[model samples]
Target chain A: DVKVTQSSRYLVKRTGEKVFLECVQDMDHENMFWYRQDPGLGLRLIYFSYDVKMKEKGDIPEGYSVSREKKERFSLILESASTNQTSMYLCASIPSGLVTTYIYFGEGSWLTVV
Target chain B: AQSVAQPEDQVNVAEGNPLTVKCTYSVSGNPYLFWYVQYPNRGLQFLLKYITGDNLVKGSYGFEAEFNKSQTSFHLKKPSALVSDSALYFCAVRPQSGGYNKLIFGAGTRLAVHP
Candidate 1:
């Protein structure tokens, strides 16, 4: 079974603080993603990494950045955390060249920016 | 770009009754449709997906979804609702072409199974 683990499950930070949400996958998938979940907005992609050192912006990427220094780990960084950034963040991973694409997700990190 | 629409924001059903969550999709080419369920404070779990061949796809937790090409819909269904089945359900789609692996998701539907 594939396992995606998030470093933190809950966090609280003051406004304008730097925050980091880390994720690791045991499957060695080539693609990793970060998403934020909000009521009525569902899950919106924040950033994705296809390979080490390669990143792409998703639907909503403002105030957020990502790092993929290694194949097994992906980190989401908030340059300046704001109250609006408070939400549940999810990390997902998928292997390349699969006939049927399926992305596995971690438990998620709930960030509270006060 | 691929997109999905879950028409209902919420669906209330009684335990033991059949439940259905509606979903529709739009894509430039043939689509790969998927249904996922998210429990409170947890990430989304894969329920099922429709690639090709069978129109009716059965998935985990006794759940299923039907793919209708004409209607451009892939609605998730369950034979009987359980109290534990209540969760947030999301429908997603990706275009078969363009080597696109990113999935566009719906706003999600909250399923409430009353006892």
Candidate 2:
């Protein structure tokens, strides 16, 4: 069984404050992704890391950045949180090489920027 | 640019009856399709996928999906619907030949099961 864990279930931050959401996957997958979920808008990709110390911006990476310091850990950072940045953040990881690799997701972190 | 379309916003079904959530897709090359389910406040879970060779695929929690190439549809189905099966379902597709296989997801369809 694959396990993906998030650092926090809920978080609240003031405007312009820095925020970090952590995700760890036990399956040793090489691909990790960060997305923000909003009603009607669906889940939009924020960033993804294909390998350690490597990161790429996704569709909605304007206010977000990601770090993949190690294989098992991926971190999403909000340099300055804003009201519009409040959303449910999700972390996913997938194995490398396998073309049909399945992406596993964490429980998700609900962040509110006030 | 690969994309998926889930036409229905919501589908209602009675318990013990068959249910379906429609999904259609468009891609340049052979499509790698996937189905995922999301419970309230929960992250999306992989249900099933269609890579090749199989049209009917079975997945977790008594869920199944059929890939129809001619129709470009991969509708999720259940023989006997359960109340616990109600959730938001998303369909995604990626181009098989694309170097960066970034999945494009549909808006999603909400399933409601009544006892």
True contacts kept of each: 0.65, 0.50
For candidate 1, write residues B1-115 as lDDT tens digits.
4678898999999999999999998887788898999999889999999999999999999999999999999999999999999999999887776443368889999999999
Score residue B16 of candidate 2 by CA lDDT: 100
lDDT by candidate, in order shown: 0.92, 0.89
Instruction: Go through the candidates in order and give each one's DockQ.
Output: 0.75, 0.64
Docking class of 2: medium
Per-candidate alpha-carbon RMSD to the true structure:
1.1, 1.3
lDDT of 1 at A99: 43
TM-score of every prediction relative to native:
0.97, 0.96
Question: Where is model 2 more than 4 Å wrong at Cα?
Answer: B99-101
Give lDDT tens digits, candidate 2, residues A3-113.
999979999999999999999999989899998888766678899989999998898999888889999999999999999998999999888788786788999999999
Candidate 2 TM-score versus the reference:
0.96
lDDT per residue as tens, model 2, B1-115? 5678899889999999999999998888678889999999889999998899879999889999999998999999999999999999999887787533377788889999999
Considering only chain B, report the TM-score of each candidate against the true chain B.
0.95, 0.95
